[model samples]
Target: MEAGGWAAAYARLCREGGAEPQQSVVQQLRARAGAGLDLAARSLSRDTCGALGRLLRDAAPFPALALADCMLGDDGAKLLLHGLCSNTTVKSLDLKGNNLQAVGAEALGKLLQQNKSIQSLVLEWNSLGVWEEGFSLFCQGLSANRSLQRLDLRNNQINHEGAGELAAALKGNSSLQELDLRWNNVGLLGGRALLNCLHSNRTLRRLELAGNNVPSDILKAVEQAMDHNQDRQSILAENQSRTHVLSKEVLSLKEEKAKQFLNLMDTIDRQREEITRSSRQSSARVGQLQEALAERHSIVNSLKAKLQMAEAALALSEQKVHDLGELLSTAKQEQATMAERQAKDLQQQKQEAADREMKLLRDLSAANEKNLLLRNQVDELERRGKAQQDQLFQLKQDLTTTVADLRLRAVQAEERLDMEKRRFKQGLDDVESLRQKEVDHMTQHMEASERSMQERMQRLEAVRIGLEETGAESGQSCSACGTRPGGGGVNQSPEPGQAGGATAAGAPGGEATADDAVTRGGPGPLLAAEAGSRGGAGQGQPAEPAGGESSAAGGGAAAGPEQQGAGEGGRGEQGTRGAAGAGWAPAGRADSSGRAAGENCSPGAADESAVQQPPRGPAGQGGGDGRSPGEATDQGSRDLPDEGGGGTARQLPSERHSGLRAGVPAGHPQPQEVTRPRHLSLRRCYRTG
Candidate 1:
């Protein structure tokens, strides 16, 4: 009868060609759908395949659906899956090698999420790797499905990354019992992740990943995990049965305990009645004890009052003793403080006195040192004065000697003039006598000789005057030109008229000035020579004054003649030399002071002054005393203040002239103006001076 019923249901399902099948035919075809429907290797048209989907859906309790190797494509798979919405009867779905691709796989995955009765799924060789969405959606659908117990995904191009997604989905899937991922592209990593997931997965009983790149050990682990899962499931089933038995025993024990509780409640009521009667008797005895206690309390209060009075007396005694001790301590502290304060004051006063004594000692020492320095300075001043006096004496002696020489020369010059005058007078007499004789002879011999005779007389007069003038110039040049020790005298006779007739009185005024300068510069040496001469004369008989004059003139004239031959009058030349030499003495004096005091003052001052001064000539030469006049002037300048910095003193020409004249002795001839004869200006000679 069952075979007949199944055969009729199959015939009915086949005959129902339209999408909307009869409800009775769907119920009759349910048994055949559960037996398994294989549509592999078929070339069903699109309309026929869609009609098959309606037939399966109409069968309310369809159990399995297989369309393997049918090449149904994604459209056919989607149409067939529409019959499995909210399906609870289908246990297995086999779509292996159907060329479903991603669209078909995604549709199937969504169907799995909606269906709760699917226990196994076979989707091998479906090209699930063609689109990642298919594999991912399928994995997600598996996570929502709790009733799917078996999965077959062999040779479906599932790489390690997709395999990993499947492994992650299995972590939450408790109902999936078997998984097939054999002959796919899953590597060792995906195999390991699946192997690890199986360790905690209690429900998955079988996992197949053979003929893949995964290691064999991972496969072994998967097999062991499946075995372990099966054992856990059996154990869990036993525990559930045990738990049910224990729950029944606990309910029976609860009822037995409730009966004992009711008996205990009845016993408590009887005990409470006996306790209440005993409490009433105890309450009466407590009242009597409280009365006696009150009497004892009053007796204790009386005794406490007496004890308080005694304690007060003892406290008053202690307070009085404490006050006495405090007063004693305060008096001792005051005495010690007074003594310490007095000691500190005494020590302070002693220290102050010592400080004052030390200060006085230092002051005395400083005053003594100052006094010693002043004494030394006074001694030095005295020594300087003595030295200056010696220099002055030497200069005065030089002047006196030169004066003697000049006076002697002047006498000789007078005598020679007188001799020349007598000679000229005799020559005139002779010429006049001869002319008279010639006139008398010519007049006797011929007439017309008177004019010639007058002309010859006038010529003779002119010749006499010229001879007198020449003689006067020679005598003046000889007298005024003084001799230097190693060089010539200074003469100004070549053109005396150029000096505005300074030589009008038969003497070269400029040359006289030159002679004075030489005398002042070399006074010591020349005077020493004059002193020797005078000494020699005084020691012996008197020397001839005439011979002295000739010797003096002859000695000085040797160098003068050459210099005089160069120019007519050297008044201008002599003026410059005199001006330069005038300062030379003083400047040389400053140079000596610079050599002495150069250590005390800045050498810059001395060096700058040296640059400004003119170069020294014969005037800088030392005298017979082996001391240049510069030394004397230098010593004198030291006594005078500089009045200007940088070793140069500022003084007007007139002031300097007065100062210089004041220094000169009364015996020496005083120049009206200390200046060059050419311009008569009081010219400044030396800044260092």
Candidate 2:
């Protein structure tokens, strides 16, 4: 039937039963006392049954469905059972006294097998077991149904055969807790089968077999088995509850232990990190101590070598003194013998003189003529001495004039050397200044490049973020609008190439600027300029002898005018010899100046220069007018500072004005002191570079 016709019929049925026909089926079901729909003892046609089945299948709110005494036979029962097969809401079904036969019983059995919500089924006053095949099928459905806990089959006219089938079904049925088969024709055979099934059936707690014509003994045994099953079920339920509580406690304890273990692991990790840090620090300290100890050992070894040299020198000096003492003793003995011989000879000559005095009177006239000739020879020698004295006076005046002229030339040379030194120092200062500017520019360029790179990275990051946001927005729009496959309303985000091009456009200028700065002469040009200045300074200065001559001139400043003039004349001669040597020693001078420039360019040069002041003082003093060039160089080498007692020789400048002042004696003037500030300025320039 159509749905409207069934709904109209249902309304008419509700009105006839004195229920409010204005309410819908669901409302009436919910408003009823048991939330059930009852059409019991009513004339329900096939159309009504279908309507009810449809309601049940569509998940109606009915918890109880009653079609008792409604005269719904096999077909009506099948219709109702069809809907209940898929129904989940109905927990109780009443289909008693409907004259249902084998067909209806089979349909009901199918309903029980499919419907999981129905816990109670009432089939009382039905002829369900009249057909063995139908009753057997119903038993089969009961064996599979797990939701039905109570089954009512009272007065269904079931005989021993049907009872045996039910007993067989009960052997596997674990859900049915109660079974009512009262007013049946069950005999000894059916009772015995039920009794045997109790051994395997654990969920069936109640079974009624009264008025079934069963034997008393079999009935009593079945009763006893049912009681035993109930008690066993109660005990199992209690044990399961206790086990659940214990499992909960174990889970909580496991969680707490895991948390504690994690905390301990964290603490150990922190302690291990601290230990590693301390060990690293200790290793570094040990390295420093080892270096210091090595330096001390080197100093001790050098001191031992010096001591050995001193001991050897002492032995040699002692041997020389012994040899001289022996020679003196031999000479003293020879002198005594010579004095004794002379005394003997004088006595013999006196005896001979006494004989000569007797003959002297006779020879007196001849001796007077010889004395007159000796007086004439003395007068000629006195005249020659006067002429030689006049010639010596004239030569002295000419020597004095030559000394004055040489002194004047020496002063002019000194002034020219001073001018060249000033020019060289100025050039070094300019080069240092230019180098400083280049370094500053490079630093600025690097900073600018770094900033530009950071900005570009930030821009790329922003573009990426924008792309992500655009993608997210596009996805949301697509899902919300359900756009067609070929739709073109949304615009796509810009590509990476376009964004990269924009960022790349501003980058080349900074790179080009950096490249230009490097090409314009970075540190390389600065070093070259410094070398050129050093070379020029070396070329402008006079040779090694000039340094000695200048010191002599300084010393001469303290003497009387005539003595100073004589000293200046000696200085001029020495200066001429230095000029001749300078012509041949240009290469050596260039090498020395280059070495000095290298030292000044080094990072530790300032510290070394400060530490080696004492050694330089002696070197400057050793380069005086009294020393030869070879001797001066040797003295400078001997005075060179030894680092950590290791004799690493270095050639430092010997004419440092500060060293000169320290080395000069108390009476001597420091003519080179005026150039000290210029040297200090040049050092400052090197340090800045």
Candidate 3:
């Protein structure tokens, strides 16, 4: 068909219409060399398609071929698929609009690798791209083409790597039914590698990725791989007619007797499940040996009841070992009769221990003469109790040196009673500054006797208004001026210890009234007994022998008492206690001082004669002498009633002369001084100023 008679009628019209070549008959069979070819719509050029591909490689197997729209380039598509590779008769081949570049798609992939009688192949609008090493050698010659069924690769700008090497040559081409790949760029990864080669392609029923940019779920995964390869070719045509049309040697002897009767019924159901699991493990070891033979028959009836309670405790330990061998033969005959009554009580305890050791050697020689007369009567009662404890330690060191000289005379009688209370508060502040300068000189003589009694009642109210204007000539000077203020004011009531006793009893004029001057006995009679009666009337005294010589000179100026008859009976009771503590008075002078203490014998009989006086001795322990006859009867009953209460006798004679010079002034101290040293007696400070 190399241009000899219209190219042999265009290769017998493309092998009698198994049709392909059109375009002006592949440009007149690419300018003439074509044994059996049809150049469809031909406008051939490229050297007339390389001389019609060397006349189909010196043409012999020329069954069908076509070079469509042949403006063929790339050396006329590598000289027409290299003359259809070792053409075993071109089975309908066609190159449409052949601009087949990559060496004409690698010479149509080595003409489908040694042309196994090319089954219908057509490369349309061929650029053959798959990054063109000739479309991966045309997918390895369409996977070693077994007799390639129809493939078209239309619009071959074949992309997704030439549609993944033509989807791996349609998964190793099992005679590809038909793969068109229309409009080129087989996108979505070459339409998912052609839907995974038609998912185990039974025989690619006709997968033609239409219009290239392939997606539609990869064309519904190639139509579910063509309905699963048409349900595996309708189950291989119902297992090839289910062997009933059998006779492949009687269907291989009925499939080997149905596989040896299903392998002997699966070895008789695994030996009947291993004989029902060895009869449930031999009925669980025969119920664990019947519960260990009922726990060894309850441990042989509890060891035959503990072997009959150990044979009744070995017959009560053989009758307590024959009653302890008859109490060890009656304790060896009571230890041989207590060793013959302990050898006759050891010969009567050795003759009563040698007559009780000679009556304990005559009672230990009368208890060693009564223990040496009780150690000489305990050394004569500890030497008469150590000489009566050295006479009570020299009578407690003479009563602690008379209580430290009566605490130094009670701290010098509390510093002479705080210096006689600061000299009786400076003699009552100098008798309240001489009674406030005699009450401001009696308030300026009662404001000059109230301005001279308001100018003598305004001159007796102007002489009774001039005696009622000299009526009856002044009525005798208004009755002698109202009896001259009631007899020149003898009224004197207000001395109840006077602090102006109610303004001297409201004295406009006066008249005695303070209980009649406290029954008339104080104020003027005892200034320290009138200085001891003017010192016994200046020695010429006879006032009862100067009051018994001023009570024996105040008991010889008593540093302590000598008791001159209790200081002459406390100076005869000191005038009713100086008129009741100088509330004062002048009425009968306390009944003449109670008759001078009933004739000087009553101050409790001079305090019972100074308490029967007779105690001075140690040479009268004189610290300034004299007074211990009970301190001369307590200093004549304490300075005769506090010096007869002159202004309460200036605080009871400095508290009874500091309790007769501290013989007792320790007022509240002793709980019990050695069994009562009479309140730990002190004495001696009578220094009054």
Candidate 4:
């Protein structure tokens, strides 16, 4: 059949399918007829194959075509594929057993890249895998083809390299579901490659590697991988169908919700209209009530004004009546109570006067006894104080004598130092004179030795000249004479002046050591004697106070019987100023000036006078001393030195009072009235002092 017959068949197919014949298809067919090309013939020339490709390009009526065993080489395949590159109607293409090589395979790969309609491709029995380059290109195209699903490359001499390419293609190709690579040269390695690709390719459901030299284990693994892909494909299809049903349900639910929303909006609109009507009615009612309220407010204000006037008049009359009645009753009650109170006061006054007279008599007797006792204590204290003054004067005289002795010794030490300095200077001058004399002697000796050495050298020179005139035998004698002069000069050289220098240096060092010894030994005894005397004076000053306290205690014991009556009075007096007295004790010892000591002791006399006064009430007590106990305590505390300076003198109120009262006779009766006031006053005094 020629292109004319092919055109007739294409028209018949289009008519049967209820579609008009495309103009481009008809034109291509007419061209083939003119070229005398037959597309339906068993063996296609390159031109026929090209004509068929052009026909397929534009709305060709054929959906499936088989041109197996047609001997279409690489050129024919390229032409056919180039025309089919843009064709959409052809869904299946068969070029099996066409002797297509690498070039043809590349052309087919390119066609797959551009063609979207070709779903099944068969190139079995073709030498597509003769070169890996063409097969790689084909794999690339296969990866990109989305419409192609089933591929047959069976018996195409595909080795492990080709198989690897195909496996790579399968990894990326999602549309391909079945691949037949049976009766090829895919060995164990290719089989392994195919197995690995199955992990990534989910759409591939079938792979055939039969008749290839694949290991049994590899073939089994490949089978398992194919089965997994098939299961995945089935699952994907089922899921897709479920998704479609769910999407439809979601659309129906959305429409139902939209209808419900519209109904709710309509209901809200009706409620809003009703609410608006009710608000208008309520606003009118509020206006009416406001007018009525304004009328009632005016009437109530007029009534309030009349009631206020009436209430004011009634309140004024009632207040006046109540006040007059209260005044009359108070006046009557005051007259009766005044008479009874006057009688009671007269009786109470008489009793109080009698009690006061008795108390005064008793107080006067006790005060008289206390005053006598205090007078005696004052006399004793004055005598003891005079004795202490004598002792202090004696200590002052001793201190003065010791100070004079120290000054005299210091003067004597100065005189001795002057003598020692004179001696040291004289010795240094003598050593210097001796050193000069030695230096002169050494210089004179050196000059003499130099003169002798010059004379010897002249003699040797004369001998050498004489020997030279005599003969070679005389030369040895002259050499010996020359050596003698040099040896004599070396031996006769004066002992170096270093000896004189050593004497000069050693003499000065000895002088310095002697001077240091004189200075160190000179004032040492004088300073020690002065320090010892001062230390003795310091030791003696403190001992005087200790001795005075001991003596005072002894006197108090010796006069116990005679001063028994005065012990209570003395204790009261001591307690009154114990802190003041203790603070002044150190000041007295350190005074050096008698005026300061007297000034500090004067307060003791004042304290004794205060003790002689009769015990009085709180008011009279302040008047007696012209100052309170608290004021006295504060003054004493101010006078007291810090602990670091005062030593034991810095005592708390209780400790100071206890120490001062320790001299009181143990068997003496301490009257409560005398001791209580004195103890309290002692505490107050020490607390501040």
Candidate 5:
């Protein structure tokens, strides 16, 4: 079947794609170059394996093939790997960008373990979501394949866990010098794991993770690790230098020791004095030993020097690589910042462009709208450019002021809130002062009330005493019955202005006038004196006990002139005030002045004053009106006597209640001010010695 099958295999190869080898025939020619055959970049989106690989296997197999980005995926890759395993071809392979998930990876991994020809592999962009398990399997393949030097799985989504597994593989894999898994969505944690692997893995020189959200702190840590890496390199150099110096010193010492041994041999011969004959022999032996020492020293030194040079070059290369890695990371960070800034600008520009269009649409009519739109587009572009220029300047100023003001406000608010809290606490601490204020106000009110009540009582007492004395003095002179006043039956009555006499209770045809309502006693002393001269009996209090006449006199005494006098005086004054306020001041004597005032006078002022503290008694009674004829006398006897009364009944907790009712201090609506200063002025905190 070799010759016949070859013909058939060649037929499929040509019919499918190998017929046109004009453009990329180098791949086909390489497959038939005798040393080895190869065909790559087949770009066969369909199944090109049976056509190509079968033909190659029939004639000769390739030692290398790179089918990168050829869309082989799992099925195609598996078929090729299985066929190639039997073919004894394909030393180096590149299956990059084939959508080879776990299926293709498994086939390739198995083939790699068994196949010895393959030394390098690039499986970049293979969709291996197999994760850590997939990496482990790949590592297993690497362990089995002794010839493999480089393996690239770059741009694969193998995360931190997978990276860790790869790191462990790199530790044992001595042959692989380059392993790139760059841009594989190796997030910060994954990137860190890979970087850690680099520390102990001397063979791996290149690693990359250009796009990732690596934290600044984590990057700093990596930088520190890098610095440690550099330190380790320096320590290694020093150690090598010390070794070199030790080697040189050892060589010289060995030479010196050899010379000493020869001299010792010579000295022994001379001490014997018999080896004079063997001196040339000793010299020749010494010469041979010297030559051997020189050769050994030269060889050892040459090897040491070469090793040192290699080490130095390796160190230099590693330094450069390290520098490049750092630069790459820095560049990546800078690039990300620049991209973000640019994105913001682009968004703003787009918005500006949209606004400009809207304005043009508003300005133009439908007929010319289209033409206007084009002009608007150009104008918008120009506007955007100008705005962009202005944006930088405006943003600089706004940001400066905004940041400064915000910082100042925050600090000032903090200070103000703190001060307010302290003040509130101090106010709360002064509770005793508040209580004392309430007590003092209560005391002042009580003292003033007591003085007013006492003055009224004293006047009433004097009137009563006068009534009793007059009863004693009258003693039944000019007798008439003790009849009720205004009864129209008895004809007994006092003369006009008579102070000592009293009208009987039932005096004939004598009616109480409006003025008589307030007359509880005789006329006042001054008015009575004037009246007494006009009448007789002389209005005076007498000290005697008598009969009917005396009883009538007793009535006058009880009516103690001053009582009527006080009530009349109050009424007269009230009338006077009412008259004055009503502009009735002495009719024609400067009456015009009074007339003007009456217009401006306040009405009901006289009534207001006359109505005593609580309000005057109602027309018939006192209690209902909350005031009595005298000092709020209670008709129902609800009031206590106006005596000590348990020393004012502990100031009537109700009075305190009344005072509090005036205004109880509750939580206040505080007006708070927050100040923000442009500058923060902190005083130096000095420590007193």
Candidate 6:
């Protein structure tokens, strides 16, 4: 049954199938146990076992239930014993092999303390004492079973220490008679502890220690009881048997002695026959005298007793008369005193009665006056209340109408506010979306520029290598270019507008990409070392040349007048480094820009304000710098008066600019009158300062 079905199952569970209510198995068990089944053996695994425990728990006289082989385990032990704690009649229990562990033992120990009728318990083959806790609990459980006479803890895990503890329990358990601790690992030490229990246990009459390897001294002690009590037992038994045998022997000897005496008596009687006749006459005379004397003594005793009784009656009569006279004198004296007090009491009572009557009349008169005043005040209040009621009625009607109007106005205002809020929310979402798109665009453009510059640098380095190799292979001029400028192509003299206008499309007269670098002859070989950041060039092994090309070129290119051998500032190369159109400028500049941008976004400064942008349009978005200063001034002067909730009455920009219109000519229509109904119309987008 489920936990929630306790009520329904209570009736149905106890009824067996196909049986009348009175004759059901549960009913018959209840009849035997009186009102409720006592011995219950419950097994969830099997019906018979479950019924046993349940029947025991429900029975009235409580059950000496045997729950062996039930396999109910610890939980079932708990359920069965939890019910038994309230039961009073159960005196014995056997929980032989239900797998009750330490926890189960502790639980049963607690129940045992509260149960009173349980007197014997068997936990054989259970895992008691397998753990310290279980052993301690089993010992403690003994304290509650003060009436327990037998405790069989056979085949348990009671070792030396546990056996010692059990022995100690026996010391306090005065009612326990038999204990079965067989088949445990109770070694020599444990057996000795049991022997110690036997030394003090007086109630134990029977013991089974056959399988136990007890010490010879302990066994001898059991045999030695005869030395202490043998005499008393033997004496009591022998005395009865000896008395019967002696009585028979004495009867036979007395019969033989009697026969001999009878013969002797016959001779003596013949001799004494004459004397017997003489003694009879004397005996008769003496009997008459003795009888007379006895009668005289009896009469004397009767006279003495009668005289003594008469004297006692005379003394009692005198005592009675004297007491009566004394009582009569006391009564008369008391009567005189009582009469004098009674007169004084009568006078006092009359005076009090008159005083009470006067006070009552005074109280009554005051009560009547108060009642009349109260009635007059009540009538005055009634008139005033009626007038106040009329005024209150008019006030109530006015309040009801005012409340209805206020409720309608509040609802209308709330609806308008909600519409304005939704518009502001949409504007905020649009603005946020635009900002995100702008950030993504900037990021993509930066990445594209960096990738292009890196590719261009790699190409420039490859071309430079090819030209140097061709120069070396040809042994006269670079095959890639086939020749140099040969001192210059059109060395125009000092043309003021024409400076070193180097184009990026040729490197020392060859191909180039977007980035171009130019350098005039300089000292120290003008080493404008550029690092590669992509592909095999990222290996960045400086482009070396065979036959000491760098050193050979350095001798004069390094010393040839360090800058542009020019006089004017028209060095048209934008970022002129030492390399002549080598395409390294864009790569270096792009790399630096990327580095700076990455640093800006590093976990350093807290502010991202450097990246934020202001809107430039009527929608209040985009990067706006086109609005003239004067236009802003005009708009500020034309704005409607600020309202409390940050929202002003929606106004067209032209309509608000009336002062500007007034200053203009009349023929040109005023913007205030000519509504543009566009960006000119007021857009209510509010921002916090």
Question: Judged by TM-score, which candidate is best?
Answer: 2
In model 2, which regions exceed 4 Å deviation? 1-27, 30-34, 38-43, 250-265, 277-689
Candidate order by TM-score, highest to lowest? 2, 4, 1, 5, 6, 3
**Each model's TM-score?**
0.33, 0.37, 0.20, 0.36, 0.29, 0.28
Task: Tell me the lDDT of model 5 at 559.
Answer: 22
Candidate 5, after superposition: displacement of residue 562 in Å?
99
- Model 3 worst lDDT run, 10 consecutive residues: 513-522
Put down candidate 6 lDDT per residue, 88-191, tens digits, no spaces.
77777878877788777877777766777777788888887788777788677775466677778787767888878877877676666667877777778877
Candidate 2 residue lDDT tens string, 1-689: 44454456556654554554434443444445335777667766665565567556866666888878888888877987898899888999988899888898799779878889999999999998898999998999999899999999999988888988998999878899999999988878888888888999998889999998888888889889889988988887788888898899899999999999999999999999999999999999999999999999999999999999999998999899899889988987887788778877887788678668756855775676676777677777777777777777777777787788788878888898898889889988888787666555544544553454445434433433343333334334434544322122111212223110000001111111010000000001111111111111211111111121121221100011101000111111111111000000101111111111012221222111101121111111111112213322524222332221111123333222111111111233321212123344334334545
| Stronger candidate by TM-score (2 vs 6) | 2
lDDT values for all models: 0.51, 0.53, 0.48, 0.53, 0.46, 0.45
lDDT of 2 at 658: 12
Residue 322 miss distance in model 1 (angstroms) = 94
Per-residue error for 386 in candidate 1, Å, reads 99
**RMSD in angstroms, all models?**
33.3, 64.0, 34.9, 48.7, 40.3, 44.2
Q: What is candidate 4's TM-score against the reference?
A: 0.36
Tens-digit lDDT track for model 4 on 330-414? 9878977997898799889988998998999899989999999999999999999999999999999999999999999999999
Q: Write the per-residue lDDT of candidate 5 for residues 228-303, one digit (tens) a residue.
A: 6556666777999999999999999999999999999998878778666678689989989999998999899889
